[model samples]
Target: MNEMINRRKLLQAGGALIVTFSLPMARAATPAAEKTLSPARVDGFLAVAHDGTVTVYSGKVDLGTGVRTALTQIVADELDVPMNQVTIIEGDTALTPDQGTTSGSFSIQNGGMQLRRAAATARRALLRRAAAQMDRDISTLLIRNGVVTAAGGEGLPIGSLVEPTALALDIEKDAPQKAPGDYTVVGKPVRRLDIPDKVDGRFTFMQDFTVPGMLHGRVVRPSGFGATLVSYDESSIADIPGIVKIVRISNFLGVLAKSEWSAIKAAEQLKVTWSSWSDLPDQSKIWEHVRNTPVVHDDVTSRLGSSRAVLGAAPRKLRSTYDFAIHTHGSIGPSCAVATFTDGKLTCWTASQATHDLRKQLAAMLALSDADVRCVYVEGAGCYGRNGHEDAAADAALLARAAGTPVRVQWMRADEHGWDPKGPPTLLDMRAGVDPQGNLAAWESELFVPDGSATFVPLTGAELAGLNSLGKLSPGGVLNDLSIPYDIPNVTTTAHRLQSTPLRPAWIRSPGRLQNTFANESFLDEIAASIGADPLDIRLQHLEDARGKELLERLAKLSKWRERREPDRNAEVVTGRGLAYVKYELVRTYVGAVADVEINRKTGALAVKRFYVAHDCGQIINPDGLRNQIEGCVVQTVSRILKEEVTFDRSMVTSLDWASYPILTFPEIPEIVIDLIDRPQEVPWGGGEPTCAVVPSAIAGAVFEATGVRLRSVPFTPRKVLAVLRAS
Candidate 1:
C-alpha cells in the first residue's frame, strides 16, 4: 500500500478517524500532501473535519489502562464537544508526538494535560471565528456540543466555520480552559472506548496484524544466559516443508518460513552449539550478592535529624532486612511485531509502550536516519512496564531486512519468560528507634539496588547479534519512596546503586515505589506490633500530610479496622487485619490499604480474604476508569506479593511457563473495596500505580499479625512461612 493508504488503514484499524482542518476557519485549505503534524502546534494534537468530528493524536498509548477514553474525556470536556465526536490515535511515531514513555502513571497527569491545552487553544480559535462570522461580540457567543449560539438565538455548527486542512496554529499556553465545575463529561463514569471490541475479540492485536507478503520468523535462543552461538546446522531443518531461510548474525539465530508453525518447527529442529558462561549468581544467594556487590555510589534521598546517632542512643531499637525477588512481566500473550524494509526505510508495527524511542533505537540499530524509521503501536498483551515487545520488534526488523520481505516475529513462551527484562531484586535494611512514650524517634534505611538507567536496557536480539546494544542491564526505577513519608524526628534514607545485577532489569508497574514502600510500611507495622499499638493509629500519629491522614482514616472506616489483639499462636488457623499507607513517590497520589488475611498454620498457606483501599488522586477524569485501574493494581500486586518470582539457576531463568511461574488465579482473588476521594479543584494525578505501592506492605502486615512472625521478604512462600513457624 502507498503511504497515504497505509496511514488511512492504520487509523481505521485503531478505531480512530482521520480528519484535517486549519486555524482561523477562513484560511484557504492547504494541500493534503503539504500538511505535516508538529508536536508544538495545536494542529498536531487536534483536527476537525467538515462533519465536525474531532480527531486527537496522542503520543501516550493505552496499554489496557483505559487512558484512551480518559484522554478523550479531557479533550471533549475542554472543547465543549460531545464525546462521540472525538477519536484518539496514539503511539504512532509518524503521527503522534514524542510524549515520552507511557510508564510511571504519567499518561493522565502529563499527556492528558497536553491534549487538554491543545483542545482549549482550538476552542478559543474557533470561538473567535464564530464571533467574526456572526458579527457578534466574543463574550456573547456560547459553544455547546460543537454548536455556537448567539444571544439572538442564531446558531452555527462548528463544521461550517473551519477549513478542511491542517490547523497550522501554535498552541496557546494561556488558552482559557473550561472550569471543572462546568465539565459535563470528564468526571463522569463513561464507558471505555476500547473495551467492547476487546471483550468480543473484534480488536486486532499486534499478533493478528500482518502486511502483505509477510514471512513468519522465530528467533533461536541459547539454553542459558551468557551463551554464544558456536554454530548451527541449517540442513537439519531442510525437511521442514515451508522453511525458507535461516538468518544468523553473530549469536542471533532466527528461522523464517512461509507459515508460523513451520517457523516454530524449523527453529526447534535446527541443531546448534553454543558457548556457555556462568556469570549469574545462585538464586538463593541473590540477596547476599546484592549486599556484597560493590556500590557505585550512595544517594541520600532524604535526611532529617542525625538518625545514626539517635538510633545508637535510643533505649529500644529494631533492625531488619527485607528483600524482593526478581519478577518478569509474564504477559499472557508473548510479544509480537511486524516489520518491513522498503527503499532503505523501515516501518515496524509493535506493542512497545515507547514507540518513538523504539523508532530511535531501531534507526540506530539499522544505521538509518530517524526520519527513515517509523514505529506504529498496536495493542497487545498487558505489560505494565518495559517488556519483550521492543526486542521482538528488533527481531522482525533484522529478519525483514535480511530476507528483503516483510517479517512477522512472534515470541515463544520460553523466549518471553527466559529473556524478558526482569524487575531487579531489591534488598533493604531498615532500622528504627522508639522513644520513651512509644513514639518513633528515629528511622534509617539503606537500599541495595541496581543502576536504573533505562537508556541502557539492551535489546535481546540486538545484543545476541553483536550489534551496538545499549548494555546488559534492564534496571527499573529504584530510588522512588526511598525515604519514609511519616514525620519521624530523626530520619535518613540512602540507596546504594550497584554496579551490576544478576538479571536484566526493567520497570514493572509501580517500580521502586512498590518495593520501597513494602519495606517502609511493613517495618512501621513491625514497630507498632512491638509497642502494642494499632497499625492504623500509629500511621495517623506520624502522618503530617492532610491528604495522607484523611486517606488512612477513610481506610480504617472502610475496612472496619479494629485494634490488634494478641494472636493465639497455638491455633491451627488464624485471621488478622493489617494496614499500610503511601504518598506515592512522596508527592503524587495518596493511598491507604488494609488487608484481611487467613493463614493455615498447619500447611502455612496464606490467603487474602479481603482488601480495602482509600485513594486520593487529586482529580477524577473517569470514575469507572479510575476504579478499574485501582482494582487491577490490587489484584496484580497481591499476586506479586504472594506468588510471582522469576526463578533462575546459575546461568538462566528456569521458569519458562505458567506451570512454573504461576500467578494469582481467578479463584484466589479477594473481594476488593475501593473508595476514591475526588478533588475537581486539584490537578489530576495518576490512578495506575499508586494503589500498587501499598498492596505488599498491607499483606505483609496481615501475615505478621496472624502468625506474630514478621515476614520481611516478598512472596512469603509456604516453605518460608513453615520454616519460620517451626523455628518459633
Candidate 2:
C-alpha cells in the first residue's frame, strides 16, 4: 500500500477520487483498482480477492461491543467459509455503504440481519454457477466450508468462482437460508477477533492513529457552555517550544505544536478571555425549573381509553415523583480526531457514531458538496451517547484548515466533561390505580424533560462553529411515553419536551427509559404494597404475555425468591431482595431483573451482593458477547445510579475530575448472573441498551424492602440514604 499521500499522489489520484491508504494491504483498493475488480452487486456485502481471501464490508463500527465477531460469524456461515478466510471492514465512508449510526443496539438487529440475507444470496449465486459448470442440478449439489461437491464427487473452491463474470451480475436476490436448528456457526460463542489486537496494544484507536507529518493540537475551553471569546493573547505562548500556530474561532481556541505535550504546554500558557452570559438558570433549582418551564404537551405519544375517568372511579390510587439529574459520559480517555484539508476537499478520521451524518454536517460547515468531504470512522474511548468526539473532530478540522496540514486534536479530560453535551435531566410523576381484583385498572404518567437527550449536532458541531442552534432538540431521546407489558384497562402516558437549559443535552445509553422505568416500577411496587400482596404475585397476576411471565419467573428462581426473600431478618447487614421488569420500547427486549442487597445501617451504605437478569432480545448472536453487553450495562447503570452525577454552578462545571464525580468502584461491583433467552426463529433485537433501564429499579426496590424506606432519587449516596432514613 502507498502509505504517503503528498503532492505527488494527490495529483496522481486527482481531486475527484477519494484517496485513503489507511487500510492494510489485505483490504486496500485504489479507485482504478476497484473499478476493475468491483462487482455489479455485492455477493451480500462480501468480495473475493484474487488471492482467494474474502473481505466483509460493514457500516457499523465496534465500540468494544463485539459486532465484528458476530457479523463475521453470520457472513462466514452463509458463505460456507472458515473464520480465518473472512476479513471484516467497518465505518469507512470511502469503502463501505452507509448504515446510519452505530447506536441503539441496532448494529446487530439491522446491519447483522441485512448481512445474513446478503450472504445467503451470494451463496445461491455461486451455487448456480457450480450447477452450470458441473452440468448437474443445483439442488443435487452440496457445499460446506466454501467447497462445492457434485454428485460425481467433483469439487471446487468458491474463490475460483468469484471472477469478473460474477462481478457483472447482481447477486442480491433473496435466497433460501438454513433453518435455525441447522445453523452451524450463528448461535455459538465465538471469541472476538478484535480483542487480541486490543489486548496487545496493536489496535489503532482514534487517539493512537498518526498520519504522516501530522501536527498535534490541544483546545482551550471557555469558562462555561455559553461563554463567548472576547480577547486572547497569542504571543504569550511564543516562548513555548515547537509552537506551530494558534487557531481561534470565537471561543474555540487551540494551540498546535510538533508534539502533544508541547501543544498542551502552549495551550496552558496561552491566556484567552471569554464573555460571560447569565442565560443559565440556577442549577440547585433545576428540578423546579424543569417542572415549571414552558413545555409543549404531547398527547399522541401514548394513549389508550379515557384514563381520567377510569382512575377517578378506581378502588385505590397511588402517585409518586422521580428525578434524574444530568450526567456526563466520564470517558477514561478523552476523545480525539485527525483531519486534513486540500484541493477544495476535506477528510477526517473520527470516532463519531454517526459518520454519514457527520459528513453532511462537515460539508455544510465548509460550504462544499457532501461528496467532497469524507469522514472515516475510527474506534475511540467510551461514548455512551454523543460525547466530545464530534466536537474534537470539528476542532481538528478547523485547525487543519488554518494550518493547511493534517492536524490531530485531542481534548483534555476537563474539556471533555465541561463542554461535552450531557445526558439531560428527567422529572416524572407516575399515577396508578388498582381494582378489587388487585389488577391495574388505570395508569397515567407525566414525564417532564429538556429538549430530549438524543443527538444534537448544534449542541456540539454548531458550538464549535460559534453557532447556537439550540431552539429544539431531536425526537429520539424524549422517551416520556412509558407503558408496561402487563395488561391494563385504561393507560395514558404524556411526554413534555420542555425548552432546554443552558447546558445542551444529548443521548446516553438508554436515556429516559432508565429514569422512567425506575419511576414506573417503583410505583408498581407501591401499589402492590398497598394491597398487602407480594410484588411477584402482583406482577405475575397482571402479566398477560407468556414471554414476560417466563422472564420474571426464571429470574425469581435464579435469585432463590422464596428461600432468601426475608434475608434471615437478623443478619449483620440489613438484607432484602427485590425485582423490576420492563420491555424496552414497550415492545422490544423484554427484561426482568432481581437484586439482593445488604445495607449497612450505621454507614448508610448499600451493597448489591448479587443480581439475576433475565434478558430476551430475540435470537442470540454470540452468547458470550451478549453476556458481555449485559454485564457492562449492569455495572455502568449501577454506577450512574449510585455514584455518578455532573454538578455545575452558574459559571462552569465544578465537577471536572474523577474526585468530584466518582463512579462505582471495583469494590462496589457485585456478582452478576445472566439468563439469555435464545429463540433463533425470531428476529434478533438490540442487546446493548435495553437491560440498563431496570437495573436501578431492582436495586432501589431491594433497598426499600430491606429498610422500609422509599427512595425516589438516584446515586443513592450516604447523604441521600441517611436523609431518607431520617425522614422515615
Candidate 3:
C-alpha cells in the first residue's frame, strides 16, 4: 500500500456532488464497441476464476437493502451462471475502488446500475474471447453454466480458457443500460443472498468481529454537548482488575482492558470532571429558537407568482407552527468497531455506509496515509443515518495505534443513545391564503435549521464559528413540500439556517424530506379540511404530473381507500385517514396515505391499528427487501412520533438509555400494508425514506380526525395528547 493522501478532496467536484468512477476498458469503451457486447450487466465484473468459481464485486453496500442479492442476480443473469456459482464482495475499501457512500437511497438506483452494466460488458468480453479460442462465430456460441457450446456440439467451460492472470473487463461510461423490457432478473422478487446467515444466526455484524490478542476498549465521552474534560482521576482505574492501560490521546480519554465488561466497569468507576452547559435548553426553547430565526430568502426562489401580495390582501388566511423532535436510528444491534494496527497500516472491520470516507478519517486521525488504512465490512447494525460506525471505528483505530495493540470498542446502549448526534429539532411556520371558492390563492412557509451535512461531527470551536457565520447559506435539506405540484397561483417557501450549539447532523434516512414533508403534508390536510374537501380528492386535484398520479393511483388501489367509509363513522374511537406524497431525488418517487388510528379519550393512549402505504420507486429489486424497508421505516417513524426523544438540561442529555429513549416494540408496531408500483422502466427510487416523510403527519391527522384535536409537536406523548384533549 502506498502512503494515503486525502483522496476524497481530490474526488469532490463541489456542490452536492454525485460521482461514478469506472475502470478502463469495456465499461468505459466507445459507444460503438459498448453496443456490440452483451447487455446483461452494467457496472461490475462477472468472471470465472481458474477454479471455476464466479465472483462479483459490487460498489454498493448491502446495508440490509438487498444489494447483494440484486447484484448477484445481475451477474447470474448476464454470465448465464447459476446463482450458486456467484460470490459477492461488497463495501471493502482495500479491494474495491471507491464508489460513493450507501446513503441517499442510491444503492440500487446508482450502484446497481453501475454493476449491471459492468457485468454485461464482462459477459460479452468472455463470449468474444471464447469465440476466438474456438474459431466459432460469437453469435452461435451458447453460454450456459459457465460453458460455451458450438452449433456442432463442441463446447468448453469458461474456466478451461482462464489465463494465468484473470482477464480484466471494464464498463461503458454511457452504455445504454438494459431496459426493463430486456431485464432478465432485476425487477423480480428474488430471495435475499444474505438471508440464510441472518436467519441462522451465522452472520457477523461489526459487533461480532474479533481478532486474536485484541483488547477491548471504552472511551469516556463527555456526558453533555460542549462539555470538555478539564481533568480526570485515573488513579482509581489503574488498580482495577484486568486493566491494561489508561491513556489520553489529544482530546479523548480511553481505557483499554482485557475484556469489554472490565473496561466499561473500570471506566465507570473513575470520577471525571466535565464542563457542562451554562443553561437548560428544553424542547420548547429549542423549537422557539428555531421558529424565530430569520428567513434566508424571503422570495423563496419559486416559480410561482407573487405570494406576498396574495397572502397580504387575502380576506381570510390560516397560519400555524409545527415542531419535530429528535430521534435516533435505533438500529437492531448496537454500534461497535474493531481495528488493528501493524506495520504502520491499520485494518478495520465495520458495517459503516461510508468506507472511503471512513478510511480517510481514520488515516487523518492516526497521521497515516489513505493507503495505510483499510476498511472492510462485517454485518452492520441498523443505520438510520445516526449509526456512527465510522466514528467508533476511527476511535478504535486511534486507541489501538496508541496502545500498540488491536482494540474492539462496543458502545453500550446508553452510550449509543445519549452520546450519538441526533436528528436536529425542526420548526415550520406556514401561512396560506385560500380564496372563498377553496382555491389556494397563496402559500408561504419559513423553515429554520442548521446545515445537516455541514461536518462529519458536531461543530467544535473553529467549525462552530464557520457554521454560524454561514447560517445564512443553504443548509442542504429536502424541499419537496415547498414546491407544490399543484399549479397554485402563488406559492413560496423560505429556509433559514440557525446555528445550534455546534451540533453536526448527517443524512438520516429522509433527513430534510421528513420534517418538510410532515409540515407540508399535514398543512395540506388542514387546508383540505378547511375547504370541506376529501383529503385524497384534494391531493388528486393538485397532482398534475404522471409520477404523482401513478403514486396516488397505486395508493388508492392498494389501500382500498376510496371505497372506505368516512373517518368519523368509527365512533368507538377517533379514526381518520390522511395522505402524503413526495419525490425524493429524481430517481424515485412515492405517494402514501395512512388509515386506522385511534386515541383513547380517557387514558390518552394512542393505537395505530393499521397503516396502508403505496410506493412507486421505479424497478423493484427485491419485493421482500422493499417491503422490509418500508415496514422498517414505519416502525422507526412510529418511535419518533410516539415516544422517542433526546432531552437536555444544561446541554447534558437526560434521557440516557433504552429505558428513557424508547424504541417501538412489537406490541406497539402497527399493521403495515406496503404496495410497490411495478413501473420497472421508470428510474428506480429509494423506498426507505419516502414513507418516513409522512408518518408523523398521518398519525397526527388521524388523531385530529378522531378527536378534533391536533398534535402540534412530535412525540405526541400521552401528556401532550391529554393536554390537547382537555383544552378541546
Pick by TM-score: which candidate is best?
1
TM-score winner, 1 or 2: 1
Worst 10 residues of 1 by lDDT: 22-31
Colliding pairs, model 1: 21-165, 21-166, 22-167, 474-505
lDDT of each: 0.85, 0.77, 0.68
On residues 238-352, what C-alpha lDDT tens digit does candidate 1 reach at each position? 8999888999998899999999999999999999999977788977788778888999888999999999998998899999999998999999889999887877888788999
Tens-digit lDDT track for model 3 on 107-201?
Answer: 77777666666766666666778899988889898777778788998888877776533345446565444556765666778888778988998
Which residue pairs come into collision in candidate 2?
A: 80-146, 453-506, 453-507, 641-715
Worst 10 residues of 3 by lDDT: 10-19
lDDT score for candidate 2 against the true structure: 0.77
Q: Where's the lowest-lDDT run of ten residues in candidate 2?
A: 22-31
**Candidate 1: what lDDT?**
0.85
lDDT of 2 by residue, 466-527 (tens): 65433236534557326666677788888777866546676778877788888888888888
lDDT of 1 at 366: 84
Question: What ranges in model 3 sit over 4 Å off?
Answer: 1-47, 151-153, 164-167, 174-184, 292-301, 458-482, 567-572, 585-587
Highest lDDT scorer: 1
